[model samples]
Target: MDSPKGPTEWAEGRHGVGPWEGPWPDDPRFDPTLLAEGDRRNVVDAYRYWSLEAIRAELDTRRHPFHVAIENFENDMNIGTVVRTANAFLAEAVHIVGRRRWNRRGAMVTDRYQHIIHHDTVGDLVAWARGRGLAVVAIDNTPGSVPLETATLPERCVLVFGQEGPGITGDTAAAASMTCSIAQFGSTRSINAGVAAGIAMHAWIRQHGDLSRAW
Candidate 1:
């Protein structure tokens, strides 16, 4: 298990990068096992051969102030996707409410590099946010909810989402500093929880993220 010997070897797999091309870069962040075993993990090019802990530490230095929270009352499969997207957007952490366990298949192992916290109830999640002085912005298409596109998301806020069918619980909605909805034109009544989370996170990014820093 050494560096890919040629260009053809580098391009031969489903995993994007092949291996170290030459002498391994001298960096503490680089994992010896990943360097020797071909570094086939699903990661961006910048993180190639980096240890999981190393990647997490680096992400922590630049993670966005916003957090993502999803209700897990139904053992929602979409929770994993939300975590994956949260990692993609470099969110500070993901809060899982109502249930401690969630399906992680959709995360594609990215959860290993993202901070995840679990709360037993909506009130617990709200308390955690309040202690940190972070606003709770719920995403739900309900009466009195503002359009996410036109609303200003708090810089330090938790973007809470609900399960697919029932939408946000009444208690959760009441606890939110504000609830915003994604605009939909089609006949479909609502979008998937995962999709809504992505939209909401990107909306926050559009307003506060450093566009020039995107890779």
Candidate 2:
């Protein structure tokens, strides 16, 4: 049988002036297939040369049950990082509370694969989570919060996080079913919001997702 060539092979070789400069760099960081095409921004193996909208449509079909919510009142760049992490984890959706416009530079277009919703305030986020039958689990370092490692994460829960400096607001805390914290003995008061979100997301995956899904 002849080789199973696809349209992608033709699209890869075509490039615009500044859009995707001359020849793809020979650096090991660049995939050989991508080099043949053009464009050099890190993305999943299946996404190279695929239009952003195409990748997003495929991701939408495989989205997970868990959702991620973040406070963007302060316009913290961590929100973008959180969205990127959520895309990698295949979260069901991302909820942004307080601000509609956030820094998308760090997301590096990963948001296109992730479902993002904007809410006016913490109350709106709480209501949305409740309507979806999702438990609102807040990640913060509070007195009664349990260690995230030992907590029994819900399968269909919304993992909510706050900005770096202020932590979660009082209203958000009150809206949550429970608040969980990462155990630490270091001098730092808490962990980065983006890192904390990823850890929490993985924890949920461990508790409910199928083991074979890891591969």
Candidate 3:
């Protein structure tokens, strides 16, 4: 095995293995091209030089039961960030409602490892969730919304988020089994959609995720 490279070197895109320093390991997960040319992709050390498919397969074995859904009514820029955060939390999958295409820049290619499904409308997403016996939990700040800090998130549920400014549509909210709001101390009326998604996912992790499995 080659010596581990420094973070600065990797950031500069000048790090990673440069051909096999010794007899190559027999692991089939390692990509020959990445091993020879150096893998500069943004990935954990456990997955260094591993093929994309291999990494995704490993993630699938431990992904949480919770799913994430975002509304893409107007090319919402925050959708990608939500997907990226879902990957970080190892969400079961991501559902996009309203639009098929979303900005991928924020996802930083993590979407390749995350399973994504599209729904033509909120009703379709609700139907899919019901069919799977998964509850729909909406994250939004509105009248009668329970504070997330005090709420009990469903272990197997789809967290639904709305567009950047409009928030959860009435139709979407009607479908949710419960609506949760992150408690805020500041004067801001609401947090960014991406940030809210991360908080909501973390809330789920705190309640039900296997902490021993986290790296």
Candidate 4:
């Protein structure tokens, strides 16, 4: 990407570049509006002026096999943050269980580039994964759960997260092929669902994803 913005962008406290200084590239991926005006979206430099569809199409080619699921019975605010994290890690899709609507404020607009699917119940999510031959890994610090730090995650799996406060339901844990818990030494009994999801996704990345492919 061309470092087109510098002092002026900083002075205005705006993000991205402002218009094309020279002849616009003859690429179909670039958005006409973005090229004529500017791109202020929360996107990478490589995709600065690209249309939303173009960026999404490009991302679809490289998304990882692993999926992410969140229990949204309580309309958790952390769901958006989890979506943002999943977008960053390039997960195959995000499955929302128990609810169709969720808060989008925490996602910072990244949801437009991420795939989201809704399940009516936890059992539906598990059955869907099983039908596709994908392992379901529940993430919570419940009893007898294996520590995520030492466990080897499957290359193709779904990492399910429960809502904050209540954590994973017993049914959700029971449906999972395995339950992995994060280690914590602090006084808090559990961590935020968003933070936990990020850790778990990174664990999957460390296990099977190629670091060199990341930006």
Candidate 5:
């Protein structure tokens, strides 16, 4: 379940280090087995031998105020990619609307370190966000959508995305406080949900994230 801690999968040097050189540090965050057998869990240097719980705990403490939600109708494969990117961005949480089972293969195990919530319907999702004073900002190329590049994203909001092809349902779009659309010059009708989520999340980061903390 390990795949580096904190930021994105910019894990360089895929090969991990050898066993402990001397006495291991007295830290509960480290995994004894990993220290003895050497850490080759495809993680970054900063989280070399840290236990899964340790990484999860650390990420929870510093997760951004923004959240990411994806409509999972028809078992969208893009959900995984969205999750992986969310972990990289350190979003507060990820919400899965509709079906519970989504293709995790694209996530590359990043979901293990990220927090995920399941909503039975769009109404449920919207209610949850509003109850917590978080704005629901949907992403889609629907009519009258604001250009995301220049929009002022809410500091504490849930950036919602829809599956590719059909895109977001009319109800979902109507329920959002505001809908944002990414600018595109290509011939394609619209980009996939996963790519849109990444763009939207980065936009929020640009507005509220602390650059010095990025790793």
Candidate 6:
């Protein structure tokens, strides 16, 4: 644990980490010692070299109330990336319905910054949504759904999504209070799941999140 003592000293290190007084890496690429030293992932400057547990602990203290849920019936690889996006937005928790394990590579180690909940099915996620007193809003373009911009998003709500090919299942769609879609002029019927998740989260932020309080 090398403490650089002052911001001036800390800023000198790579990634604004520290003067990292400990042993250095021996590799040739930007010094093998630096690479071997600690967690060098591309996180914010505040989280450089910190252990995964340490980063998670810090994030927990400031996590927001909004929750994110994604349907994982087909074991979509996008689920992990969506979770990572939720982590970036500091969503209270990510609910995974229909499956437990998701691909981790796309997450870029951001799963450590997030809390995940596993639900047996869409009904389970709906129950959890009820327990939290959150409005369950699904993201999909379908009849009777409103434009997300016009919809008044609740401060505490669950934004649920589905797989790439099928969108959301009928059961989940039935359970949701509303399903909103991104206004797209492109030829594609829908956007990528991960991109859709990000867009949905930002929409929530615009409506409920205080930009001044965000990182």
lDDT of each: 0.91, 0.81, 0.91, 0.92, 0.89, 0.80
Clash tally for model 6: 7
* Candidate 6 local lDDT, 46-94, one digit each (tens): 5655556667877888887889888888898898788888987889999
RMSD of each: 4.6, 9.7, 3.8, 4.0, 4.4, 8.3
lDDT minimum window of 10 residues, candidate 4: 5-14
- In candidate 6, list every pair of residues with a backbone clash: 24-33, 25-32, 25-33, 25-34, 26-32, 26-33, 27-32
Q: Kindly report which residue stretches of model 6 are placed more than 4 angstroms away from their true locations once superposed.
A: 1-19, 22-39
**TM-score of each model, in listed order:** 0.92, 0.79, 0.93, 0.93, 0.92, 0.82
Error of 3 at 63 (Å): 0.7
Best by lDDT: 4
3 or 6, which is superior by lDDT? 3
Scored by Cα lDDT, where does model 6 land?
0.80
lDDT of 5 by residue, 1-215 (tens): 77765443356545687887898999999999989998876556789899999999998999999999999878888999999899989999999999999889898888999999999999999999999999999899878999998899999999999888888888789889999999999999988778889989999999999999997
Backbone Cα, N, C clashes tallied per candidate: 0, 1, 0, 0, 0, 7
User: Where in model 3 is the C-alpha error above 4 Å?
Assistant: 1-10, 13-17
Best by TM-score: 4
On the 0 to 100 scale, the lDDT of residue 203 in model 3 is 98
Worst 10 residues of 6 by lDDT: 25-34
Model 2 clash tally?
1
lDDT of 2 by residue, 1-215 (tens): 75554433234423221233576555443445445555544454445655666667777777789999999898878988898889878899999999899989878677877889999999999998899899999999999998999999888889999999799999989988989999889999988999899899888877886767542
TM-score of 1: 0.92
**Model 3 weakest lDDT span, ten residues long:** 8-17
Q: Give residue 158's error in model 4 in angstroms.
A: 0.4
